[model samples]
Target: MATTTSSYTRTGVLEVYAKQQWHKVLATLEEDHLSLCLDESYEVPPITNNGTLSDSEPSDIPESIANTKRVVRVVKQDNNGLGISIKGGKENKMPILISKIFKGMAADTTEQLYVGDAILSVNGEDLRDATHDEAVRALKRAGKVVDLE
Candidate 1:
């Protein structure tokens, strides 16, 4: 006996199929709970100093250095996205800064999160040196919940 096979020729059919498969797998993985993990990676410019080191110096040195800092932000969807600031840095630790740009809902808190808030981890993964873009991509790929405050 011979068996016949069916094939799809529509555009993005493969993508759709893959998405369905992923959803099915995710569903099975989360059968015990409704928790979802979300993370985002973004680029943070290095600190710059333009002031002269000394007044006696004839020329002023550009204090700004070009270095890349990777920031990964994680948020739990089911928990109302309540957490500390997502911005990666030690200088600014306000939640308002993070909430200002997050595409999703923002947390309600009296204290604000700033641009320099240090990011410690995402979904239990340490993001000490991860780039902002890398973190964002990883979070999106994980398909977790996220909220900005």
Candidate 2:
């Protein structure tokens, strides 16, 4: 018996390759007990002649670099006085309150410190001048005990 070889076409090759690649990926994930995580906000619709439209694009860039930075002011006040407001009078303020009350003979030593203390500085740099995320990252870098007083 003789066998003849026929030339293969490339039109559907990419699709076939993609399917095979997907299968390989799934197999690898199964073997490793890994899964892909997708955001709940993502929505997919059937493809049309005009192509699918994405509500947003996923980028490989870090959020710290991609997102706009804002300043978060820490204020000192009582539970009744605590209120958070967006800068430029945007909206109502959300207050940060502490529920645990400190009780001990050493209360005198801690009396100088109070619960509504906002982080005013990190590494001696005033947070009032820094952006919200920037101040947080700076505090993390400083390795100091962040507290209110």
Candidate 3:
């Protein structure tokens, strides 16, 4: 495989990683300069026999990074606060996700969070298989800093 030089900024790399789509990001920085070397032939493994991953293996569907992690902080005020409502997935087995965001709230103001983004984790705790009340409890325990990833 031939390696090629590509101009990639740190900010851009962070943005892509933050979206949690790219499986790997390799960067070379020298003399206050940086570059990215991409290996285009890398392949993700197929789904396992049990329909569940053994570890942190990437999903079988490569087009979309469904398991990507993103963090949104809902800042709190003395009275006014983070304005968002959540609901459990339609199927009991599915994870909880954002149902709605009220107008003029911290989440609405940021515009980074969305209605359908799945709540993967809260404050570094995994909520992937949590029940409706369990997920809500985690969020409520977060207090002023609501870290939704």
Choose 1 or 2, whichever is better by lDDT. 1
RMSD each, Å = 21.6, 21.7, 15.7
Across 1-149, the per-residue lDDT of candidate 1 in tens digits comes to: 01122352111100012321211111112324332222223222222223323111111212341122333444445644443323323232211123133335332232233333334455555555566654554445544443221
Evaluated at residue 14, the lDDT of candidate 2 is 8
Quote each prediction's TM-score: 0.27, 0.23, 0.51
Q: Give the local distance difference test score of model 1.
A: 0.31
Local distance difference test, each candidate: 0.31, 0.29, 0.60
How well does candidate 3 match the true structure in TM-score terms? Answer: 0.51
Provide the global lDDT of candidate 3 against the true structure.
0.60
Q: In terms of lDDT, which candidate is strongest? A: 3
Q: Name the top TM-score candidate.
A: 3
Report lDDT (Cα) of residue 98, candidate 1. Answer: 34
